[model samples]
Structure formats: C-alpha cells, structure tokens
Target: MTSFSPGRLGLRAKFAVIAVAALLLGGVAVGYTLRSTPEPSTGPAVTSDGPERRTTGPGGPRLMVLSNGVRSSVALRDPAGPREVSSQRCERVYAAADTVACLAPAGALEGPKLLVSDRHARARESVRLTGIPNRLRVSASGRMVSWTVFVGGDSYAGSSFSTRTGILDTEGGLRLDTLEDFRITREGKPYRAADANYWGVTFAADDNRFYATLSTDGHRYLVEGDLAARTVRTLADNVECPSLSPDGDRIAFKQAVDGDPAKGWRPAVLDLATLETSRLAEHRSMDDQPVWLDDRTIAYALQRPDGVNDVWSVPADGSGAARLLVPQANSPAPVA
Candidate 1:
C-alpha cells in the first residue's frame, strides 16, 4: 500500500491524486464528488429557527444529516418538512446518545480531523489525523467513536487504496489510532499481513465488542473485535461497512455483488447467531454504510449520477420496497 501525506500536497495535487486514483480504480470516483456541489432543495426549505437542534434529548425522534456540508436535523415523522441547520461542517458525521462525532472538512495543507461534540453541538474535543474522511460512527451509548479514512486509493473496490481505521473512547480517553496494532485471528490461527486494512466499524451495545471490515490480500471479511482484548477474529467473508442493528441480533452491511467489487455492492443483513444473509430489495449499487433506522428498517445514502445524494430506507427483513426518506441529504443518523 502506498502512503499519502495530505498536508504536503497542494489543492490541485490533491484533486489530481484523487482523480487519477478514481480512474485506476475502475472509474468509480470517490464518494465525495457526489457531495461536492450543492443541489436544489427537494422538499421544504431548511430553517434555523428551531431550538431543538441538539441531536439527543427530550424531543421527538429526529434524523441528523448533512445538508450540503452543514450539520442539520429533520423530524423523523416528517422528513420532508423543514430542518434545523447548524453552522458546523463535516465530511462525515454520526450521533448517538449524548455525543456527536464529526470528521471536519480537510484543508489543502491540513489533514482531516475528528471533532467530538455534545448533543447541543458544542465542541468537546478534536484529534488531528491524516487521510480523507470516509466513514464515521458513534457507539449507541455515545462512549466509543470510530472512523475510517483513505490514505492512498479512493474506492474500496480497488486494490490500490490504503485505509486507516481508528477508535476512541470518549469517556476514558483511550484511543486506538489504528486497528493494525490489534491482534488478528484468521481461520482460527494467528494472522498477520502488511496489506491488512480495516474500516466501517459498528459497535455492539456493550461497546466492548465491535464488528468491522478487514480487507487483506484480495478478500474482504467481516471480523468481530474485542475492544478490551485488542483482538479480532474473522466471522464471514465479503462483508463491508457492517452496521449493527438496534437489537444487536443482526448487522446491516454492503455485500459485493456476487462476491465481486468490480460489479458494485448490494445492501444485505446478516443474522449474527445464525450467520444467514438476506439480500435487500434495493437493486441499485449502494456504496455508503447502511444505518439501521430501527430494528425493522435500514437507512443509507444513495448517490445519483449527477453528484446528488438522497437518504433511502428499506426493510431489514427483505420484504418491503426501498423508499426515499430524506431528499437532498446524506449521512443519515437517527437521533432519538
């Protein structure tokens, strides 16, 4: 894997690097391009007139999303209605419990950073990091936060891309800068590899146990990790961007079409105990991580050909059709 130093690259060089990487990665450009240009409002106009901007608290269920680049929220019951927009800008964001995690937009001469904030959107902590932001997640209890970034390549389907995934304990201040430092067990034996790349982490309710995608050699596997033990063991193959369901009995993940990344990915659900996989009804290729809106439904961002995104939801049991939940929004994080 090649190393990338974002701080050392100029703005033009950075874009050039990404453009070239995208072409080499089978013409699937980085997901950021889909969000670069702002699109027309699809529903009611967003407003900042509301006092319930906080992600979590004594309010009705709301869904946190990125309206263009700014942090915003919409009522879960009426997603097409007006929204409360915030001043904070993030490349990727997620909220759970009383905590919110944001991947601050990267600058030409600066690397991306992790910004931790409270439910009220107050900045609490910031950690400097490298690479372009790709994925971010906050544990259900809001105590653990994890993120993934692209260090070299752009798309997950390409072999040239290098990734760095990290975890931070908000309460204890324990940080794992890279999952590479943790021990890995593959096929019931000690595993070690220079090509190992971990990403798309989803934590269990306990926060001690987690699941993430481990790509090595040429295969992608879903691995169950123990935060306390600092170890991970392979559970299944061809699972990427695993998002644990609210009930914790299953995981919503993107599975490569026919076990091939060049073909794209399909949203699927895996029963943890039975290890059975059920493919969802949505046939379109979804590159974003699927977040569970509840135990019975899953939400994810789908990008159109012209660089526009909309949040879509599908039944977790593979029974219902996919429907647009929020238009002109990305990074759907349900906050109750």
Candidate 2:
C-alpha cells in the first residue's frame, strides 16, 4: 500500500492523484442477508407539532445527512432545525425510496462494511468490504445501490492510491464487485487499460442505465453504462462525479478547471441533449458528487476552513448565487 500527503503535492497533482485513485482497483463482492434490528434514535423528537411533522411546507421533505458520522436527517422545510440522529454511524450514506445504504464506520479490530436498511432504520442486508469508504448511492427506484472506496494509499496528492467501486442489484441479488469487469468503448472503439479506474456512479431512473467517471492515462471521461449488458461507452470528457437530474435531461458534475486537474474543479451542469455545459455560480473548488435537490437545484458539500462541511445549493441553470442549505452536514439525499 502507498501513502499520499496532500500538503506535499501541488493543487493540480492533489486532484489528479485523488481522481486516479478513485478510478482504479478490483475486488470481490460478498453478500449476506441481514436480520431486522432496531436502530436507536437521538436528538429532538418529531412531535405532531414539531417542524418534522409534515412532509411539505414547514415540514417539507426529509433530507438524509451524515452529522459528524452519525446517520441523521433534517426537514428540508427547516434545514437549520433540529435533526433526528441515529446510533448507526457511517462514513458515507445515501437514501432513495425505501432503501438506505450506509458505509458503516470501521472498528478498531474490524474493517468497514456496507449496511442496507429501510426508511425506519431496519437492517435489510450487509456486505463485508475493504478500504476507506468514499461514495455511496441508491437508485431512484431503490432497486440498485453502488459504492466506492479507497483500497490503497491515502489523500489525493500522489499516484500511489487505488480505488474500487461496486454495484448491487437489490432485486436480482446480482453484484458487480468492480466496474473494471465491464467492457468499455472509447470513441466507438474497444478500449483496454490496466490502469483504468472508475467511480462516482449515478444511476438512471430506469435502474438499468447509469453513469460514472473513468480515468486512464491522463484523461477523465464520463461514461454511460448499461447494467444488464455490463458495458459502458464514453459520453464526454473532463466530467467527474456526475449527478443526473430528476428529469434526466441534465447532469450536475465537477468539471476540472480549464481542462487541468492541477487547477482544481468547478461545479457545473451539462445539458445531455446538446452537450453544452453551464458552470454554476460557485467559484470555489468543490471535490464532491453533486446531488439534485430537484430538477432546478443542485446541492453539494463544501469544507470550511475549520474542516467542517456544510451543504450548499446553487441554481442548476447557473443564474443564482450559491446558498447554504444545511449547516454542519454532508452527503445530502432528499427523501419523502
């Protein structure tokens, strides 16, 4: 295993190392059936008159988040309001429909694991895994789940790290331990590379189509995938961490600044129909997978100087200023 220190690498090299590490590695997927268990809850209770009583307006939708590693949630209607925290700790988490996926925190003597649960926090399934969890996502239909982890090395300043990404079909009980097994087509021609890496997967509404980032050589590309066929085709270049809009017409992604990772990245939106890109109002470098709060709004985490992360939102059309949505929270996913 190799170790990388961000402080020793230049801005561009730091991101390059991270992007490369996030795209490499291969592994096996182990699956297990989980027995239902109650998860203890903390924080303010949602009483009938509380801010979380309704599912809209003053109560709006529920926004799942990781509060200092605890699985917590807040009402979108009152994002700054009290949160309902759970005892289940995770390094990364995401929720959709009835499914909630968590990358359980590693123990002193044990490695990290993936836990699948229901909306009420009832465990459904668990998978033993390796590496440090980085990203997690659930399909809109709750039938598919995916995750990414750093298998070797640490930080984003060096080329010593490797990444592994996996996907699971909850309904079919099929697992793809690594995207490397999938055939790839670049520029309408078969492509192969031992150093190819893939990560930041975002699924389509159909549950069969998906998208992810593929890094090889010195280039990064956005690849559209077909789960059943186990094939992926390059869609565009310099796109990373793509989050498809609810309408499926646009993709919210992180674009390497000026076609150079050393320069950092900017949050931007891509119109799938025209291949035109729209850079958001946020000028700061964001190293996150943007989530769609709705068809018109995109939200992502921004780390503050104090190392605390806050969820911020900007208009997907690139017309409005960025605004804080949730303070002291990250890995946001909207749930009803």
Candidate 3:
C-alpha cells in the first residue's frame, strides 16, 4: 500500500484532482460520471467507540442504549440534563459533529415524533414515514439526516432493510424522502432476508447520497446501499461496517476475507474513482469499526482478538503506523 501525502503529491496527481472536480462542477447523473472526486475524510470519526453507560465529566456528549431498549441522550454540559429518547431500543448510534442520530425500537417511542433536537432533549422536531428506526446516520453539516425505518411487526420485526433518503430544511414541512421517487429493481420482490442486516450508515460532506454496509453473510459479501438513487449494489466483497469519506468519493471499511471472524475484520478503503480497495492496517484479531480521520488518515477501535477495544488512528496511505488515540472504553463515540 502507498502512503498518499497531500504535501508530497506530484503535479500530475494534483492536476487529476482538479480535472475531476471541474467535470464534477456541473450536476452529473448518478452513475454516469467518468471519475469520482477523491474526497478527504475530514470529519468526525463515525461511531468512534460505543457510548459508555457510566460516563464522566463535561468534555463530551453521552448516549445510552437503554435496558427498556430505547436509546436516550444526556448532555454532560448540564449534570441534570434532560434525557433524549424515552422508549426506543437503541440498536446503533452515530454522531456527526454535534448532531447525533440513533436506531431506536419503534415500540419505545412515546408518540409519532421521529426526529428531535440533539441540543434540546425535550423538543420534538420532524417525523418520517412510520416504522422502527433501526439504522441512523447524521451528516457533517447537520443539514441532512437519514435512517432505515421498518414499517412492520410490533418491534424488531425481523424485516429486511429498506432505504429512506431525507433532507432537512428550515421551513419544516414534510421531509424530503428523495429528490424524485424512483425505482431500482423492476418487478422485484421486496428484500426481506431473514439475516439481511443493515449497519454502518454514513453521510457525505455534501449530504447528498448516504452509504451503509448491508450483508447476508460476513464472508466475502457486502452490499453498498445508495440512499439517494434508491439502489443497492455490490461494491466490495468480504467487507462490512463502512464509513464514507467527507468529500464522499472514497470509503473506509472493515474486511475479513481470511474467514477468521476474530481476525477477519480489518481496516480497508475503496477509492471510488478506481474501484480499488487498499488494506491499510490488519490486526491479528478483529478490529472494531473504522472511520476516516481525514482523506489520508483513519481512526478505529482495535481489540486484541477477544480482548478489549481501544481507539487508534493511522495514515490511510499505509505509511505511518497505527497510533493509540485513547484508552479502552466499552464503546467510544468521538465528536469533531
């Protein structure tokens, strides 16, 4: 693997980026562009670590996946801050800068409110199509939020994941589910695989299309879901829990092609322009989810096989070695 240093790139490499951006200046149709702009992953680390149940201090915001199954939020700024979610079983949680999003069990909701202000715990904001929000992602700009909600069963209905792309606006009218409602697979059966699980939803800097990792099996198979186009396609195999780049062109994910589940999931990246995946760092045991610290550096939680997990960051170009960022926390979530 080659280490890409923005400071040391040659003229030809710099020119290529400019050329790609120039062609991309005009609105190009979703799958028609000749080249994808190599975006810098300059944003908050996605799901840095799971939220700690017993949090301390005022240095950060904390989220709790409650026992009642609902995910609740508490701001450390105020020791007596109001709780965020009252009743949703928190399946997954992600924070984009200051705004945070989570997957909650539909049954945990007290009313029809789907969105809320992460700043103000009690305030109800916008609501989307009815269903249980099992996978959630917030954008870096906090202007767009998207989640996969299932409209079936009483709780975790065992339903396959469906796409719901949304844009947040100031007027606060009905949420924009899509730019234009379109279909992907024609005359197709709805995807409701028993184990068709969706995780790792992320927002690009532009907040246009969202990306997630969906899998039927953890071995040599992973599907990338395009939230805006209403399509799901194969991008990389043997990969799961992918986080998108801030500029939105490349992706950082974990792959376990060796079939060793414990040591299988290691940090990797896919350059969209070339459709090439570079494995940056691989631990003997499975590493936790990986997120881009910048276009060139990635930070992730790594555990000693079946041991504890801690946060670490390394250059994406694969030059600099992985450096420990923080000590082991049950689940760590980093704020930008």
Candidate 4:
C-alpha cells in the first residue's frame, strides 16, 4: 500500500487519484452494502475539560483541519487559538451549517470510518466504510453528506486504486453506497455502461439536484444528478470533482487537458448557465476538488517543497494571485 501524505504529491497521491478513477470504474460495486461503524472510543462526544470556545466570529467561519496532523480542530488565519473539535484523528473533514463530518482510517488493513458531529465537534453518529476514505463533503445545510474512498482489489486500478463513493441522507436516514445503481444518460442518449463510475458530488441549494463527476469507457463527464430520481445525465466532458459555488451559479472543478487524463488536470470554474469555463490562477497539477471560500474565492491544500501543507486561496475569476491562508493545514473546510 502507498503511504498517504498531505503535502507531497508522490506515489501515494498518484495512487489516490488512480484509486478515485477505479472507484468510478465499477471495481467494487457488486452486492456491497453501506453502513455506519461503531463510534471508536477515541472519538469525542463531550469533554469535561471545559466548554469549547468560539474560534471565529462575524468575519465568517474558520478553517478546519487536523491540527498538528494528530488533533481535529479549527483555526482562524493562523493556527493560534485552535479549538479542539474531536479527539479522533481525522484524515479529512467537511463542515457546514454547524455540522462536521470526519473521515479517519480505522487501521492499516481495515476501511475508514465516518464520524458525524455538531459544530462543537461532538459526535452524533459513526459509519463504517469499506475503503480508505479520500474526499468528504457536507451540504450547506448539512442535510446531505457524501464521501469517496479507495476500495482496493486485484481486478482494478493496477495498483489497487479501486474506489467507492457513497452518500448519506442525515435527515431521512437513507444511504446510497454506490452511485452504480443510478440511471445515466450520456450525450443526450440513454446509456448503460457497466464500467461507469461516479464521484465528487456537490449538492445544490435544493439538495435534490446535485452535480458530480461520472467516468465511463475511458471518458469523464460532469453530470447533473437527481437524488429523488436516482439518475444522472452528462452535462459536460473532461470535468472532475465538481464543487458548486456558494451562489449556486458556478462550479469549481478540474479539467483534463488535451483529452488526456494522464497528462494531469488544471483547476477551473464553469458557469452553469452559459457553460463558460475560466481557468484559475494556479499552474501546477491540482489533485483536489477546491472548496469555495466565499462566492468569489476558492481554497485548496498545496504541498510545499519541505513536505509541509498549506491552504491557498485564489480568485474564482482567474484574475488574482493565489495567496496562502493557513500553513500546516491539509483539509481546508470553511466554518460556515
């Protein structure tokens, strides 16, 4: 197994991306069931140490990360005044509307665990997963939670890069282990491809309508998904990891260049109405699905030369320079 790193884009990061591709390739979608895992004793429900303090105020939400790569916490511009959110060490976290979802590996051979908690970082529920978790997301209202993981196997992802993506309806108690069952339409025609894979889900304001990346037959598509209908239709091609803007009009995503995925992808934004795509400020290969800092800016984790991770933000319009937001941060989720 490749070792995972927050700051380095080494074999581990390459395998992570390959695993995501395998996930969409139907490598682990046969008769699998999605269920929550028991809360690990290492998790936090309440702390007798004292009440948690407010880390951010009217300025907006603070950035959430695994502080020191060991403790789950949130911080302002700097890591100072870091407020502990959970005791369990999280590999990734997504927070919105007072809801925080943490994805942490259970063991070297076992799959990861998903911990749902309040804004205060108190545990609410825990879900056992079947793979190493990669991406984590929560809807603006926190009613919809989605996750992507690498499900290793011999049949897919040459290097055991198989992946599995799932969604949990927190309010309705419904779980879709894999989008494999969802009906799909490609190029405006009813399509049925056994190799199809879906991931990187971004919910709309209504939640019922969402967007995600669907890959099949060696091609990737930006798909508009309907939870109610359990259906997804291709909206555009070459887009992966679609993150809807806070205003709901634009999406931050990665676009594969020259129709060659192996060449790597560039960060860009797409307008839903006009279908206009604008490249972001960054020039390096971005393996992340960027998070919108607000309606105007986007933030993502970047690896420094010394293997230290930092959160950097850039204007969504492709006009400004990328600026560092927090040093030593891996997953940068807004406090909203």
The number of the candidate with the highest lDDT is 1
Question: What is the clash tally of candidate 3?
Answer: 16
Q: Rank the candidates by lDDT, best first.
A: 1, 2, 4, 3
lDDT of each: 0.88, 0.83, 0.50, 0.74
Candidate 4 accuracy as lDDT: 0.74
Against the correct fold, how does model 3 do in TM-score?
Answer: 0.52
Q: What is the per-residue lDDT of model 2 for residues 1-336, given as tens digits with 9 covering 90 to 100?
A: 888875778989878877776655321111111122222133343322111234333565878887777777788778876776666778888999989899997899989999998776677778888988988989999989999998886543235667899999888999888999889999899999998888899999899999999887777899999999999999899998899999999999999888876677899999899889999999988889999999889999999988989889999999989999888888998988
TM-score of each: 0.85, 0.83, 0.52, 0.77
* Best-to-worst ranking by TM-score: 1, 2, 4, 3
Total clashes in model 2, counting residue pairs 3 or more apart in sequence or in different chains: 4
| lDDT string, candidate 4, 111-212, tens digits | 679888786556677899976677888999988999988676422222224567889888888988899889998989999987776778899989789899
lDDT of 1 by residue, 176-291 (tens): 88999889999799989999999999999998999999998788999999999999999999999999998899999999998999899999999999999999989999999999
Candidate 2 CA-lDDT value: 0.83
Task: Point out where model 1 deviates above 4 Å.
Answer: 1-40, 44-59
lDDT of 1 at 13: 88
Between prediction 2 and prediction 4, the one with superior lDDT is 2
- How many clashing pairs per prediction, in order? 0, 4, 16, 7
lDDT of 1 at 2: 78
